[model samples]
Target chain A: MRLRIIKAYFLKEMIELIRTKMIMMPYLMPLLIVILFGYGIKMQVTGVRTLILDNDNSQISRKMILKFEHSKYFTTTVKNMSEKDALREIKKANIDAIIIIPSSFEKNSLKGIKTEIGVFIDASFPSRSTTISNYIQGVVMDLANDFNINSSGMININTRNLFNQALRDEEMIVPGLIGMVLLISPAILTALIIAKEKEEGTIFNFYSSPVSKGEFLVAKLSAIFFLVSIAIFVIFLVASYLFDLPFRGSFFLFWLASEFYVFTALGFGLLVSIIASSQIVAIIVTLMLTIIPAFMYSGMIMPISSMSGDAFITAHIYPVMYYNHIIYDTFLIGQGFNSPTNISYLLLLFGYGIVLFLLGLLFLKKEIK
Target chain B: MKIFITILLKELISFFRSFGLVILVIYFFTAEVYVAANGMEIEAKNVAVGVVDKSAGGMSKKILSNLHSPEFQTPKFYKSQKELSDAIYNKNIMVGMIFDEQFEKDYYKKLNPTINILIDSTTASQSLMAIGYIQNILMKFNNLELPVALKMHKLFNQNADTGLFMGVSELLSVITLLTTILTAIAFVKEKESGTWDIMLLMPVNPKIIILAKSLSQIIIIMIGVVLSVGLILFQSLDVPINGNLLHFFILTFFYVATTAGIGLFIAAVSKNIMQISQLSIVIMMPIIFLSGAWTPIYAMHPLLQYLSALSPLSYYIEGCESIFFRGTSFVDLLPYFGGVLILGVILYWYGFRKIGKLF
Candidate 1:
């Protein structure tokens, strides 16, 4: 009898889901976010606009200037500007850094006297400034080494990047984005689905009828779970194919981990719906609980271990934090099913899903209290 | 005027009374500031590394010791390549290195023995920085006698506190998003509750209603901005607001006006709260991404870099940075401020038309 009721409820919910564009949103939203973030977020700082005010038109000075111009890291614009104009440009943020070559540059180099190349960087954005300084140092160092000045005890280091060989920021971000995409729509969709019944007074239909609360709850979970799974699958394929993200681990393991994550997110949404009286309230609560914490506390941008005190504890409790670790480990580092770190976090997420689901069932009432 | 006053007062009361929205607003502002202040660091510091030193030569020892400190940790010594790779797999270390046995012998013989390094580049930016640091150490060891020097001056932020800059930008982004979402939801909620139709049927001008609703939202959002900027940013974080406070506030008002206008337009088109929420996310994602808050605007592709100008959040971020970090006066920020004002007028004009037709 309960099975029949559950089946009836599921069919009704599915029909409603199909009719409304709301049902299609979970899939579309992730696709949109993936494309947007894929194109947008870049960590490698390039094309630093540099102005070189060379007073020394000497061949040596011109060579150094050419190196900066030739390099992909900098967009060098050679200007014969005064110190005042250079300072004004830096203040105005028209130029990121200024390379001033003094008239004595070539003379000092020829006489074996030490010459200082003045580099003034706009430090308003500290990260960019630091990168600019590093790039400048590299350029200058290459020039110094080209001089073939003999030095003692020269040891060369071969830096080889493991896993992400190219050190592509996109590789790291794409995996993290899978977690972000899943967290964004599913939780809110589930919360709104349940809260809509309550707000529109449709939930009372089950109270007046013989249909069990368990049937209703199961029906709702299955409907959302079904919709969100398709979205996750599409996102996974897009991320792997389009972004060239290597799926080093087993596909089944990745799918299993995603299912566990989706369940936990849905459980969180169900809990929010039970507490929230309106759709607006449910959305705000779900978003505040999910998006903010997922983005901030999860080891997406900042690694969980790097975070101290409350943030570490906060990361520990959130299910996304566990999945974030699992996804990154499995995808990038190629951790297998038996991998201890991957196994433990994935298990923790499963446990989180069960607990939240049980709590959601407990809070979901037959009558609007 | 009386109708505007009554509508504004009613909206204000309802806003304060919505405990859920209030808590969310408080949480978003406080958590954003707290996370921004604490966790955001660009420089890779204290990364754990595994070192396999077969040579144990003097040069290798000097290089290993130099690796220990702010950029990297005291690297755990390993016996073989397998153990180092295992450590990386377990994430016990972010990087692994194996020094060739003839490292010192080759150095003396001018046969440059390579110190083979394995870096887990999942944290790409930090790993890149770590490579730079390692290269720097090697270069210094190479050029012990050669005095090729370059003078570097970090102009504005002498200490180069990246967290401070991130915190300020994050605070502004949150304020813009929160205000826009809240204002739009406020209008959409009334429509969903059927109160909007009654107000339209009553003897009230649509213009007065629009003016009142926007005014209330702006005022409430300003309060949040003041709290976040004054108390959290200025005092708690000790982030410098180098420009004129009065000018900053005025510029902020114009920017808020632009966002509020966008919100009203979204609300006017949306039939229910659900649609409002969906539309808001769709609209907000690109704006937030392109706003130069998380990623630098200059880093984006040139076309996107140009298109980012359309997002009011972009202008605000630029204007805020100029005022806070560069200590640029009001005159210097005229372009950004003017952009906000122009955008604000156009959006509000369209919004007023759409909402008036609905009435």
Candidate 2:
């Protein structure tokens, strides 16, 4: 009786998702996010923008101007421009910012007068604006030190992005891209499976058919499991070969962890689809259920522990915690976290995945009507 | 006016009928407020740090002891930069402090000895705070180095920059995006349930129906805003609004209108909630990523820098910072609001055409 009932629901779900346009259409979002982010994500701050309004006209001011002109971060867009022109340049955003050495800056410096060398920045673009401000602050401080009269001590920062020795964007983004795709694995399948059945009017047929519910559930979920595995394998190849993500760990271990993570994603996606009234609701609920918490708390970029207690707890509830661990170990670090603390995180996620799959089973049962 | 009021009431009833709607509201509030408090804000308070001192000398000891003590969140120590960097990558550590040898010698002779500080700039807000703390410590070092003749004028509030000041702005942006997205979800839900057709067959024009739906959603969105402001006030999560509260609300009004219009557009173009939701993610990704939430916008590609200008949330965040944190007046904010107004009008116009086709 139980097997027949489960199979009845399983076939019912599979038919509905296959027919639903709304549910099926979003298979594109994960793919698009992957392609775009693969190209976009980077850490190294480039295009350090600086505008020039040099009024000194003297050899010293001109020479100092040349030093500002050719730096990795600083790019001088304009010169010999009036204050109006400079302000106009700011409004037009002709530059990220402007560096104005007053007409008598050289004279004042030579005379040991504290003449202000005004560096006007376009604060509209906050990050670049802030970057422009910071780099200029450093360069101007260096110039002041060269004078030795009013020197502000320069502080140098050296960065070593630990696991990622190279600190390449590809390594950083490709893993995130893969996680993002896998995160959607179960969700897309779950979303479409039931909706297609509902749309195709095959849900009634499943109920009439003699197949046991257990066998039916097995078939419906097996199809999803197979598709999800393919998606994972595809992402792995892309991350490994196309994006050239660093793979120092055993591929088998990575594959093992990923299989476990995919099961969790599928279970959650199934649960989401079960609750939804239509394909649209299924997708939105699933995305929110998976993406928001994962993106925020899964310790992918932001440390979940840094957040408040409740938020921290919520992060663990999503599959991102385990899947992200798998990604980090496989892609960047080359091995799983050797410490028990790291291993515990993976175990905790595995436990949560089981719970989520159970929830999917229960919710699917409830939604059979 | 009476007809509009009736339609508005009707729409409100429908929105309330769906428990899903209220659940979404809760998600928006919880996620935006709580997440923003921890991650989105520019304010970093009581930052936890780890400090390592290999140099066993007196000056190094002083710096280490200072960092070791609870004054600066009692920084942790690792054997080397390698271990510390690994901690950062694994999210086990937030900041790393290393004091090189000859620390005092370089101070007196002006050798400009570098005090290396490693921070995870992924959470840009916290990283900035760590950077500020380092600055404060170093500034103290500088004061001891020089004879201390000149008193430098503090032109700006150095600590008040983005951390606490911009936290509210970031929260506002997040809340606004989620609200508009939720409202869009309702429209798509209507389509999926076949209620959209029923609305279309009514005596009212489809445009009026859309307006009524949007207007009802506006009320719901404002509830979220009120909740956020109330919580911020209670929690004191951000620096108090320095500029003007009334102006801040006024700015929120325009922002909501623009987002609502955009949501309406999305609802009309997309067939169902799932499609709209997916598309919404696509639209919101750049807005969130390039908005300087996690990483600094200046650090992004040039194309993204210019593209960020098109994001209404960007203007809203800067404006909120100006009013609430920076204490800038209405005239100072005209430029930001002007940009928002222009974008809102253009998006509204474009969305209107799209909605017409979809409806």
Candidate 3:
């Protein structure tokens, strides 16, 4: 609790981090995550490779094929291939789907006799296939409308996307990536630094010194918390400038929430360091706890509402999910601390920080066992 | 040869002795795989919807009735559009609909009555799919007879089960992560424990030592893969093996070796276990991202599509999928094998020399 003792420990931790060149990690990790996930992780399926077998060889069939070609969802190549060959192409993983316009397709369409356009989709990846089928359905509907098929009823549905108008995947992914990167890098760094002290027997310096366990732990956490807070700011700028992420909510509110979340993450690292006997074990344990949950249950790849049973409960228990909500709400929904629900989420983050810090302190021994 | 076996056995023994790491490996291969496969729902399920039925008419009620369980939760009726909008903002409901008073009357008069559907698009996949579902319901209400019917045959995965795909994909990602970290730590641990000098002084080729250590970790990871595939993918999730299981294992072997090369390079440069974890995340994440494990390759930007070719995981994932789902023949599997081998040899050689010189 002494200020002088805390300062000495903090300065020592900082010097060690600088000597190991670990200072670059806070900046480097976020940039890497943003660039890789921002540009790389796309949920919207586009450019599905499609092969068309147009047996009708008529203008109507050609026009139908053109519709598929023009649509952003598909890249169509028309060829004189048989059904068997097209199936072979799909099986070889060469193409994603096949469109077959039979020889009688044009004849039947012109006569108002209902015909069928056969679609063979490679459903190896089920989600992609579902999206492909939806796109194909849309294209077919557009074609039907053009032919004056009157598919539209007396009732029309006008759909509007509220938060992300264009439904850009990055809008969802970048903000979530910020939460993910911040959690993993700081946690791993803090865990490894403490575990290294134990492994190298340097922890005896604190064990034999006048520094209380609380002061030592707090000083270590503060050093990482300080550096990572700066890193978070840099990441926010990167997100806003490089990714063009709009910040619609209160900046002050978001900043306060971030500090709490960072503290919780660092405390989790502290707990892992105390439990692990070696630096390698600490890294592995930290990753095992943080990475999978953050990716799977934090609503990063899958929506939390879509989860059921144990998964839903798991999502609620993790601090990452709460932080994920804050990120999305602030970045996309523009809802800040005004919403009572958002305030609750912020408070939960603070609670998790306090709980994790107490847990780490409780486990940290002043004398080596 | 004797030196290699001795070091290999020593490495394996030490690995087994670490009870904490052993338990973690088991948990990752078993419980982690199980939760991911069973938990993640890619297709839209239980989409919470709210509606303001001002019309209170037959057609509006009929449309509301169409929104049913599994795909959607039964629609909750709200008094006004503002209330529904608030519900959406609060994320209480993903989709909200407001039916004007003229809705049913206009429909009867053959005047197209528009229903305003507001969607929260933060969870893009769910919202997009939900939109499609709503449109279908409205289209059915339109009841317009079309000229042509589009018949879709979903091949490979007839039921569109997300679990089967997710389980296998998670297994692959776990493989990449473990192989890289395990191999890197094997080398870095020796340095951290002040045993690197002793390892160098031993009467053995540095090449044999590095090969033995890295291979030991890969062997451990391969066993973890087997457990995941057997217990989680096959037994629990019922993921089918359409092609020869041997082919899947072979492709995995090449992949593990390739990633182990990256781990060796990481160990060569990193001074501690912390650097190993940091460098692994920096290096491994991009490979996973570009591999199209989470995202479909076709959906990525053209430049990224081109860049995916350089990632060894892209080939491994494609090969495994083709083997499992498509039952592709060995002849057609050559390109995947070639990609893995070519990449593996270059990486393994570079890392082998990098660490060998230090010796």
Q: What is the TM-score of chain B alone in each candidate?
A: 0.94, 0.74, 0.96
Candidates sorted by TM-score, best first: 3, 1, 2
- Assess every candidate by TM-score: 0.95, 0.73, 0.96
Q: Write the per-residue lDDT of candidate 1 for residues A114-230, one digit (tens) a residue.
A: 887898998888877888899999898788778876744567678888778887877978888889878867888889888888888887887788777677888888888888888
Task: In candidate 3, list every pair of residues with a backbone clash.
Answer: A153-B142
Candidate 2 interface CA RMSD, Å: 6.8
| lDDT for each residue of candidate 1 in B185-212, tens digit (9 for 90 to 100) | 8788888888887887888877888889
| Cα RMSD, each candidate | 2.3, 6.1, 2.0
lDDT of 2 by residue, A48-72 (tens): 5666777777876776667777667
Tens-digit lDDT track for model 3 on A1-369?
899989988998899889988888778877887888788766788889999998899988888888988888888899997788788788788899998888898888888898988999999888888988999999888887787654323677789998888898878789888888889888988898888889888988989988888898889989999999998899999889998877888888789889999998998899899898888788778878987788888886777766667888998999999998888888989889778878999999999999999998888888858
Docking class of 1: medium
lDDT of 2 by residue, B1-359 (tens): 66678888977887788777677676656554555455532234445566566654566555555453222455667777677666765666667777776555665566666677776544443465456556656556555332112222111233324334334645676566766686687677778778878867778776776667677887877777777676763355644555678887888877787787778778777876556766677677776666554444566668888988888877877677566544665776887789779887887767667776765
TM-score of 3: 0.96
Q: Name the better of 1 and 2 by DockQ.
A: 1
Candidate 1 matches the true fold with a TM-score of: 0.95
Best candidate, lDDT:
3
Q: lDDT for model 2, on a 0 to 1 scale?
A: 0.62
Docking class of 2: incorrect
Mark the regions of model 1 whose C-alpha exceeds 4 Å error after superposition. A304-310, B57-61, B107-111
DockQ of each: 0.60, 0.17, 0.70
lDDT of 1 at B241: 69
